[model samples]
Target chain A: MTTLPTPGAVRLGLVIDLDICVGCHACAVNCKEWNTGGNAGPLSDYQPYEAQPDGVWFNRVHSYEVGDGPAGQTVHFPRSCLHCDNAECVTVCPTGASLKRAEDGIVLINEDVCIGCKLCSWACPYGAREFDEDVGVMRKCTLCVDRIYDEARPEAERVPACVSTCPASARHFGDLGDPASDVSRMVADREGMALMPELGYRPTNRYLPPRAKGSGCSAHAKSPALEPVMPEGTGFLGWLDRLLSA
Target chain B: MHPALSVILFTVASGIGYGMLMLLALFLPLAAGPADRLFGAVSLGLALACIGGGLLSSTAHLGRPERAWRAFTQWRSSWLSREGVLAVLSLVAIALLTLAWPILAAPVECIEMTAAIAGLLSAATVAATAMIYRSLKPIARWHNRWTVPCYLTIALASGGLWLDWAGAATGVDFLPRAVAPILVLLAAVVKALYWRHTDGLKSATTIGTATGLGALGQVRPLDPPHTAANYIMKEMGFRIARKHAAKLRRIAGGLGVLAPLLLVIAGGMVPALDRSAVLLAAPVATIGVLVERWLFFAEAQHVAMLYYKADAV
Candidate 1:
């Protein structure tokens, strides 16, 4: 069961468009608000109001300055449990608390069976799982299992908190098993990529390639609808960019 | 990554135990002294204590202590299981040799040969323990020929220290003052090689490869798919303080290798200095090795670290 599942088969996944994301951090805040109030109560912050804030969070957004000069800029990366098919965390667990659901291909933790050893935390490379110090157990993103299947919630908003709250429509969720599903289609059209696939984790979530800032001919980059030739770079924007670089 | 005190104690204590016993066994090839029996017995006892206490301490890290025995059954494939098996085998070999001490002292070459065989078994068992780490291919730092030799050296060094201390207590010269320099030199070379090998390694995963788009010029994490820190980050994403690591490296090098080497050289040179000086250096060198081992683990960056953008960290 721990063997990695085939790509675009039994598992459902998400394809997030990073190019359109406004870095509002709505996904992270909504995720915390929903999960803490749902099945897993209180994500347990260890000094919420202090200078050094630390606690168990199922999702985290890291803002980074990736490059330098005119071609480089800031990028916001949000992290969550990958729900990997290989799932090393499951095998490393002394208890059977860590498991991947066969029915939905979603990895989950049974809080009751967990003993707070934190071995699964080490086995994972993604930094996805968080230890609930108060309860003495590991907690992670369940891909909003409770919300997605909740009969009480509206069917239209049944997706994960991060997916539903994306004001820029950057996040998409559907069955990756169906090649025609929204997620699958987006991956094919936008050239989506798996995070750390070489580790053989086979994570369910996919990250759509960041769109190139300018028009380019490479398949990985976005091609402009119509090509234009700039006249000796005389624009004010180009002048400012040159000045900044100088 | 969590740095559990019990595990640290378990590994360090057990590493010392097996390492000492292995060394004593190696010394058997040099000469079998009258006090060798006493040395063997004390070292065996300490090794057993370490193994037993270590197993108990390791249980503190398990979710279900009751399932600990299940690990032993998986030795056919698991390094963890092999480690357990080797620990038991070493214990058994020590027991067999201890029982045959009378036969060994009977002034018969045959009896001495049998006792020597037992010593070989003990050494072999400790070597097997070292191989457990060496066998893990996923852990690039652990999978190497040097790992076993380093472990053997540490074991011998620890045992020699014990024997020297015991001999000093009973007015016997178990470890000659001349032997310390050689031990320090060997240990230093091994440590240096391990550091050099691990330092020059490449990141296991690149941003381009991670996303399965090998042909892509460059791929950076734009919007990470989630909001919270999950299991992977808590475990494999651990990072150490660079400033403290640099300081500790100097401390470990000085104490574990350099100072010990100087002490041994000084002990060998100065006839006026008592054997106690050689004996004193053992504990000092051990404290140094312990700090060195701590840094070894703390400084090791797992291949999985690339997923967390640790290159930037």
Candidate 2:
């Protein structure tokens, strides 16, 4: 009764470029805006203008300083559902609610069947699945399946909200199965890395490493060097320094 | 590991239950003549009660109790599935043994040997049950090979004691009181070995390793990502005191090992109170093991502990 994973019409996935990302969080904002209005709506913010704030976000950006000394700098990494090839989340669900699509390789959740046991959430190490307390079901990134396949939407704008609103064009979406696809070419040209490869989750999303910076491309180059100068007011320490130097 | 009470009760209660059944199955065949239907009936009844109690307790842990039957569908991949299957097999064997006792009474050689074989099968079921928890790779403490033997020891020790009491109450000397001493020694050694093994095991991942950087320098969290505790922290980052932990370990050692050993030794010296010593040691050992199992869940460190800033990832 066991069957191998069948080849689908489209293998939907994402490619995130670390080089051009500015960490402005516009993608996160747009994602919240679109998803809140669309199928997975109302991200449930605890309080908008309160002392303490907490809410569910589809995309979260992390800023880290890597390298050392002159070459050390900040890199912004955005994280979301990887939609792994060997998804433990799907298999761990006891209610048969979590499932992968045969047509496009996109993983989805059936809210009606979900018992909210949170086993699927625990199985996933990426912290992708979110529990909706109001509905008593698990929620996750659907890869915007409803919008992409909509015939009414324009061809150019037929992509995820995060990808469409990326101001720096750092996010790319396509089928990676074909070698000639833009995502495949990008991955081939620039060495793309999967997060937590050792875990063997086999995430669908791939991250392209930042391009190396050229000579004289440092951010802190404009700062002036310290120079010795005479003090306006004379102090005991100043007098001591003068006496010692002489 | 979250200390889901249902699972704890299931493992402990069922362990005692199935283990007692194994003891009954072992002794039934040894009668000088045909098996006593009355004695056989009592043994089978106690075994069913224990298994039934365990199954009932485990179901309470599920969020949706109605959907509990769905868990048995994934037997190919889950240890929980195998445990269920083995429990059923043990139940069926007990039923068969009970029914045949009245018809097959009398013959010392045949009865004793069949009972011994049944006892071994029951023990195998206990081991399989323990292996369910031991198989998880993410939890370093439970995944070790020692989990199965430790569980088996607890079951044998507890079940043997209960059998002694039942036999005494019914005015039948079915099994030896000497089983208490063996159980005590075995339980003591198993606990010691488990402690020794876990002490040498390394942390699953370091903070540096979690970040995908090979840096050797000390890394501390400058700021936690969120103010409220997430699900991961609540489940995996439970911290217990080192001093209290050491103290509890001593208590578990005394109850699980030392007390039972003393009682058995006393029974051996004063032959009059042999039954009493075994009966006393069994409850003491169960209480001790319950405490031990609680600590096992509480003290276990998960790889996700790296995210909570408890240590170097």
Candidate 3:
């Protein structure tokens, strides 16, 4: 169905721990390797081993300088399709090529019907969608759709290529819709958050915020445990407390 | 946001085409012109060609033009689909009016009905085209209140300039000539307001907010994800230099608004040059709208840019 699934549906997604990620881009590389040969195979590269090598990548890792002065930190951010509940990419499609699976909440494009309008790319705030120049169609993260459901593969290996390949074990894949799920528990514990919440895409994917660095926060600098003095209802600890109690 | 030539031409041409068709629809039914077979054929034929050619030009940019028919099936959700459906329907309605023009000796009741339908459909299609851009919340410049009004007025202004000439050629010049200048002025005012409104605004999404790291003092892109420019950057990171945009905006205003307004007024005041002045104004106004249309895409800052080096999208 093109419309969003009701809340509390099986919203399968990722939880990336920013603190642990080393910015190695192993996930990105492995993603390209596995997906290029998978269902959405032969991900096009325009000029490989040439002046400017360009291709379609479902995942990208960016490094950012967070905070300021000595308190500032370098944070590695791996971006991909968040599989937003209100997936703008799906609705903007003139052809019914882009669809969000009502059962699992995975946003997908039926390439056969795809006219390659590229409007889906624009609708995505995360820059997740990539247009294949060679194929002349849009390609994006399928959340390792082919491998995820394959009963033949070993249970451990059934996870997404990115999650399975993360060197630091920073990336995770599970049902985020269930608070009891491992990924959802990780979100509650680490105070993971979505990117650009103001836009209201309601992305299922969560990013575990990087810990405080330098002299940014005295409480964080001292220890991960114990509370800093903030309002009773504020900060991650308070949020976690509320989640745990509820 | 890359300003593809095909899209620029499509918007400019179709905009004017629809504009002219709308005016012709009303004028034909009301007997604004002689309603002779030759004048009907030439005027309606010219309008249809512009609209048809412009619509065809749009398909050239599609990655898979062969599957464009599938675009019509999703009008329930997509504005582009709605536009596709409307464009074809308006074409059929206009084509009917065009066919009726040369064949029918007298004004038929069916002609009046068809013209009304054509006019509404043409107006709706043009509005839908504007909505295609205006509905995109990621593009702050396009999603604003000013976009639709700017599109509608500009279309009328540019299309009416030629309609004035056609009216004069068919022995009824006064009405179109008078109205074209007013439309030009209204379009100019709207265009100016749109520019002014967007100038002070910044894309709501910032790099910090995009990364969900704003609360962490300051944030900046340290290492880009890839060495090569990705699809997002290539497509959405298009930035025009300030001077160039300013210069083009002036050119658009001069040719599209001021020139057309003056020429149409001149066509009215100077009876000798009359229709010729209006004729000269049409292409000038179209080129102006063409440039403006290009700027529409070029100036739009996509929200995705916040992840890349953009401080604000």
Candidate 4:
């Protein structure tokens, strides 16, 4: 039951663009919001209103400074379940509850069948799986299965909540299994890379690396930095600003 | 990585159980007379009790203990499932062997054959348990070449100690006194070698490689996704100080290895202390193995922790 589907089966996953991701938690927040009341409802929050606020989040956006000082790039990396072609999380489920869909290759946990041994969580190298203490089951990104296939929802709205809500248009979702698919073409054009490919999870998701300096046609002609309001100490505030900038 | 009591107990206790079961099966053929049935009852009772207790404790940590039955279905793909299936099969074989404890009057061939099969099954069950950890690629400490050997040797040493103790008390040769010491030495050596090999070994995964951004430069987390510790952090991010781990290893070695070895050697030297020393060795070695089990989990660095600000896994 944990065996992956046919190799060419539609692999539904995300393509996150690192170039434009603004370190916004919108996707993660939207994911939690929709999923809290969606297929996996009431995503447990241990201490939402207290000094320590923790909850189950399907997506988590991490910001990293690659390099040091001014030369460094602030890359916003969003991590979640990749629904890999060779998902150890699915295979490691002792009760056969974690499985990759044969049709679309979306990995899912059959909560009813899950014994909640948490071995699946241990098996997952990505740290994608989260144990729901409230329900006594593991939870992860469902890819909005309920919304994606719902005929009642609009075509555009049928996408995953994270993809739908990304303000910077950094997230894209489609079937990567199809060579002719838009997602696949995007991968080719951008030279999108897989995270930790050496681990051999065969993660379905791709990440478009930040475009090289002076490579992609940028909106701004020069680096975005604040210039002194007045030339060379026309005001005390201006002088201070120039001094700080130096 | 969390070092949950349930898992530690399950491995240590069941290892002892399976080890004892296998030894008893092997020893049955060496029996001379009516003493066989009494030995069978006592050894089987102890082995079964340990196995049953350990199995039940494993379920204590499960989120849904009621659905644990379904775990047997995925033996084809899951090591955990295979462990479940094999543990049950081993129990059946041991039960049958115990119920139909070989009669001295009965033909020798059939009894020995069944005993061998039960012994093999018990060994296989222990292997499956080790594999549950060994197969995990993310936890480098568990997935290595040392894990299986460590488990097997530890089981044999612990179980052998018990058998030797039982045999001494009952004046039966369940396992040769010489054999238990050899196993104890082997276990001690293997454990020392494993520790030596793993000491200061850096994980292949690092923050830079994890994000696939090592080409750019060193990748350091500017901001974590959450301020509070999440489930992943709490589970996989367990940190044990070097000093703390070193002290525990010494404790485990002293109790599990040195104590048994010394007790056996001393008992051999002083025949007067032989019976009492063997009796004390079993419980003491079990506690040592328990401490060793705790250190096993505490020291393991899961690859998933790399993404959560761990410089390396």
RMSD (Å) per prediction: 8.5, 6.2, 10.6, 4.5
Please report, in order, the local distance difference test score of every candidate based on alpha carbons.
Answer: 0.65, 0.69, 0.84, 0.85
| Best model number under DockQ | 4
Better of 1 and 2 by DockQ: 2
Better of 1 and 4 by lDDT: 4
Error of 2 at B152 (Å): 3.5
All models, DockQ values?
0.16, 0.21, 0.54, 0.70
Off by over 4 Å in 4: A214-246, B33-35, B102-110, B200-202, B241-243
Residue-wise C-alpha lDDT for candidate 2, range B85-173, written one tens digit per residue: 66767767665555555345535555555556556667777887777657654566877988998888878777776676566555676
Ordering by TM-score: 4, 3, 2, 1
lDDT of 1 at B92: 72
Q: In candidate 4, which residue pairs clash?
A: none
Better of 3 and 4 by DockQ: 4
Question: Candidate 3 lDDT, tens digit per residue, A1-246?
Answer: 344446557998999999999999999999999999999988998888988999999999999988776677899999999999989888889999999988788889899999988988988888899998888789999999998999999999989999999989999999998989999999999899888888888899999998765455675667866675664676898899879878
**What does chain B score (TM) in every candidate?**
0.82, 0.86, 0.94, 0.94
Question: What value does DockQ give for candidate 2?
Answer: 0.21
Tell me the fnat of candidate 1.
0.20
iRMS values for every prediction: 5.3, 4.1, 1.1, 1.0
* Top-TM-score candidate index: 4
What lDDT score is found at residue B260 in candidate 4? 90
Tens digits of per-residue lDDT, candidate 3, B57-79, equal 99887889899899998888788
After TM-score superposition, the amount by which residue B207's alpha carbon in candidate 3 deviates from its true location, in angstroms, is: 0.8
